[model samples]
Target: MLRRANAIAIFHAIRLQPGISQREIGDRTGIDKSTVSAVINQFDALGLLERVADESRKGRGRPSEGVRINGAAGLMLGIDIEPERLVVMSAGLDGVPLDVSEYPALPSESEFAGGVSAAVAAHLARGGSTLAEVRSIGVCLPGLVDRSGKLISSSNFRWGAVDVAGELRARFGQKVWVDNDARGAGLAERLFGCCLDVQDFVFIDSHSGVGGALYLEGAIYAGSLGIAGEIGHTKIVPHGRICQCGDGGCLSAYISGPALRDAFRGAGLVANSFAEMKALAEQNIPEAMGVLDEAGEILGLALSNFINLLNPPNIVIGGGLAVLAPYLMPPAERVLRRHALPEGLAHCTILISELSKEPHARGPLAVALQGLSQLNADGAFPW
Candidate 1:
């Protein structure tokens, strides 16, 4: 286990800085040279790292060598199941994607499951890799995922009590792990996003629906039943609008993609997607701007409550609506400052997610890599 920790640290450094030297890995990771060497040897045995000599160096001196993660060592498969689409990606240990595929999400449960399997197969074929080479598969669901990896409910996808992990494992004959999409994205943000510097943070994703996760001390607080970070359900407005969750004035009802589209429709603005809404707003459409501003303010008020309770140093907003941060964040910030405690509000920074463009795709890749790191010889991830 200690060797595993050392390998993870070294591998993480190599992932961050390709062509980094052994000495530099030790300097950056604070692992001693001997321990670094030992761990690197272990990784070499596992086919996870390789040393490449600097061929451009001057003739007389010994050639300097640098290390990089062996891209072909193993692959992680990331599958993100959305209401409208199923996105898949094959990524290396360094988080560099080799292939990606997308398919329309079918309403039939069996067909959707088959589509996911076929997508993975096609992605692997494009990359010339196989199921045998995949280290693990991470499935992202937009619902309440329990400790046993069962999705209890999902209004967007209309799923209930599905053994997601078990199904994937049975299909692929490989390790499978499952989690809420928001929480999976939060894990990615911690490892590869702005939260690297701030351990205590909240990641809110405003996709087709709204969801979020809380990270404290560099790990997610999954709560007792793994439903802790469902921030979108928190009531914001008193009896304003009906939410899909059978509640009134939930934050998701005001800030999600469906909500924004609903607001646009009510105002006589035709926007089928968030992109069109953004375009309308950029064209100086008053109704479009109003819709976004109102949503932002509602999000800020909801987040202010989160701040009062969690006191996180950073709050990252991602997913489709993140593109509207320019129009949305100022009003949201204003509301946050007005409602949140002075000390916490002063310290917190609200920023758009760096992984906003394809968070759903990158998130599951990150999760698969994490599960790969935690696996035992029997292909089980021990929490």
Candidate 2:
């Protein structure tokens, strides 16, 4: 299984850079030349890899062969159901997104699933690839998702109950993976983000709600019931304001972007959305700045407490509210430094995630990829 994993890693590397030579693959992958040769040869024999004769470096002792991934080997699918729309993407085993599509967010859970199925079918009809080619499907969702890919609830959609995993599996007839939006973003950062070099970090989303995903010792900590990083639900003011979760004083009650927008309106400002808040902030509107400042303060307090408790190496802030980092970072840092234990506070660093796609949605795609590798308990990447 370890050897197979190495081979899959090498294959994925070559897939990342098509037409790569064996020496280059080995050099980049840190795998031995003989191992690379054996893996390549084995893959060739299986018809899952294609090698092309190369004459470009003919003068260098001996010629080398360029290798490319067999697109037909398999495909992976990612589905993200946000508040406003459903997003779908198709990628190769290499994790390169080949296609993307979106549709109405849906008025109900069943409607959401129905929209996703239709969107996926539409993408497949484009002629590049079909649903029959998909080996695994990962879903990014807005709720507490179990390790088994079941959704506990969705605050945004107000979904009280739903068997999302079963529905998706039944519809697709393929392996299905489900994960919380923040958790999925953490995976995206872990797999491909600035935090790649750092372990034990937190990934936060600062949008409609303040949520995060925790990575401990280089692996995500989903906690019991997969609610590990539900930071937004943590009580902040101890009774300051009523929250959507039927609780008051939650961090999300005061710090989420949407909450900030509401506060702006209460302050005699008329900002209905995060975009308006951003524009208002740019105009140096005192009300807008005040809302962000308060949010930063709460966020800072949350981080300070989090830093003391977890002692993570880095605190990466992402999501839409990250746009406000520049304006709010100072106050946020002030609160963090003021509240955290000196040593732990000083030791931790804060950053923002830099992913093109919505991280919450992309997270499940990563779960699907991992599930593809673990279709069997033997612990191997499917090739």
RMSD for each model, in Å, please?
3.1, 4.1
**Model 2 weakest lDDT span, ten residues long:** 374-383
Per-model CA lDDT versus the true structure: 0.78, 0.74
lDDT of 2: 0.74
Candidate 1 Cα misplacement greater than 4 A, ranges: 1-8, 19-42, 52-66, 358-360, 375-383
Candidate 1: tens digits of C-alpha lDDT, residues 192-257? 876666668888987767899888754677888878899888888889798877788888888888
In model 2, the runs with Cα more than 4 Å from the true position are 1-74, 126-128, 356-361, 375-383
lDDT per residue as tens, model 2, 1-383: 45755664676566667788888888987889998888788777655567775445667876778888676578888888787777788877656677787767767876666777888888778747777788778888777777666778877668866777778778986477777777887777766666656767888876657778888864677776667899989887887887767789988888776688778888889876566777889999887788888888888888888888888889888776566776678898998778989999878888876672343345656766666544244321232
- Which has the greatest lDDT? 1
Q: Return the top candidate by TM-score.
A: 1
Model 2, residue 56: distance off in Å is: 14
Worst 10 residues of 1 by lDDT: 374-383
lDDT of 1 at 53: 72
